[model samples]
Target chain A: MEKGLIAIAAALAVMTGMVTGIGEASVARQAVESIGKNPDAADKIRSMAILGAAISETCAIYGMLVAFLIIFVLGA
Target chain B: MRAVFELQGTVFYIIAVCLAILVFLIILNMKLKKFDPLDEPKGLVLMAMMGVNFIENMLKKDTNKEMTEKLGPYLAFLFIYIFIANISGLFGLTPPTSNYSVTLTLAAITCIMIEYYSIKYNGVKSYVKKLFEPLAPFVVINIISKVGTLLSLSLRLFGNIIAGSILMSVVYQLLARVSALIPVIGKFNFVGVIVCSVLHMYFDLFAGAMQTYLFGTLTVAFISNELPEEAKGK
Candidate 1:
């Protein structure tokens, strides 16, 4: 029963990636549109987009960390 | 002592740092013949110049000319060290960045740089006041945000590299098992060879380069973000 619970918890932790993926998808879309409109500013736009995407991805990373802990530390 | 020394990733960390230093030393000691400005550069000179140009451009983008001049060498060293460490996985060594210790130390250094710049540019009075700004109770949240930058920076690099390495191993294991089901061809593990290389190209090469660039760029961004607007460079 405990093992089953651990598995479910791990799965739930990784589910945070669903939200993060959607967030970053929009970030990338807008970044591409901005670059298309201003070709000369592409470099600046690309860096800003990447930075924003990375910040948004942190919640998913934290979720993965928790999942790894649950599986490896608790389940073990 | 044995446990500390036996940490699996330490050796790789040392190897990566040494390799970066070795590259730096070799380039430092190089005696290049003077060439015409318009002539095509060759060999190590060309590579070294290209790397300098790239690092300088990156530094100039985030900070003022004086800040770049001061921080350029350290940031260049950082870029080289991180790139070497991240890509070391390609050569069969576990990338040191998969270890939280390595990433945390790098993040801590970045935090220190940010604080140092903030104090220097904004002054101690303003820095402390800004923390308590608009309300006194917000200090807790302000402190958390300061610490969050360190945690988030370290975890971003660590999680990405560790996840990639773990996934690669799992893929290899599954591929090996699948190949073992074949009769004679299973001995060569051809399935793994064909598929694992492509996966390595993405996980090791592409991810490593991207994370290295991101880490370096973010370090610059965080430091400059802390500086006053007047102090910020074009």
Candidate 2:
């Protein structure tokens, strides 16, 4: 029962990726829209978008770390 | 039972670092004859010059001539070392950047550089005063945020690389199992060979380059923000 609960907790923890995916999707969408408006600035906009998306990815990573800890440390 | 002293990827990381240093040493040790403006640089000279020029141009955006002169080589080295380390997985080696300790130390160095430049440019008095900001109580929060940058920087690189590795391994395992269903060819992972190359292109090459560029850019941004606009030559 405890192991099952731990599995559930890990699953919950990994749900943070969903949040990150949504955030990154919006970031890419805006970047593409801006590039369409001003193609000359696409390079700068693309870099900025990638940076922002990468930074936002830290949240999901933290969640993943927690999930791994729960499964490996606790489940063990 | 899991070993308490996990030494995962340390050896591979060291190998990657040595490889990066050796490459740089070779490039640095090369003898070059002075050439006319019309003469084109060839081979290693072209690569070395282009790398230096690229790093300098990137630094020029955020720093003054003196700052760029000081930081250009260091940032170039950091970028190359990270790019090499992150992509070492392609050569059947564990990528050192995926290791938390390795990424943490790298981020700590960047954090130290940020603080060093902040103190150097803005003076010790202003540095301490900036921590207090609008109120004395804010110092705790300020310190936390400063430390947060260190953790975030390290964790970002570590997480990205590790995630890519984890996903690739899972994919490979799945591919092997799927390929095993075949009758005769089940002996070999034919599916993995075909699919993994595409996956490696994104997971290793693209991600490695992007992370290296982001790390360099963020390091420059953080450090340069501490300097005055005049000092930054912008």
Worst 10 residues of 1 chain B by lDDT: B27-36
What's the distance in Å from true for residue B181, model 1? 2.4
Please give the lDDT score at residue A45 for candidate 2: 90
Worst ten-residue run, lDDT, model 1 chain A?
A57-66
Q: lDDT per residue, candidate 1, B1-234, as tens digits?
A: 356546465765667667767976676555344545687887767877898898888877777888888788878877777777877777777888888888999999889889988999899999999999779999999999999899899998888899899998998889889999999879777898899899888888899889888888888888878888787666
TM-score of chain A of 1: 0.95
Q: What TM-score does chain B of candidate 1 reach?
A: 0.88
lDDT of 2 by residue, B1-234 (tens): 988886665775677667777976675655344434477878767777898988888788778888898888789878888998888889877888988888999999999999999999899999999999989999999999898789878887888899899999999999999999999988699999899999999999999998898899889878877897778764
- Distance from true position, residue B57, model 1, in Å? 2.2
Where does candidate 1 stray beyond 4 Å?
Answer: B1-6, B20-28, B31-39
TM value for model 2: 0.87
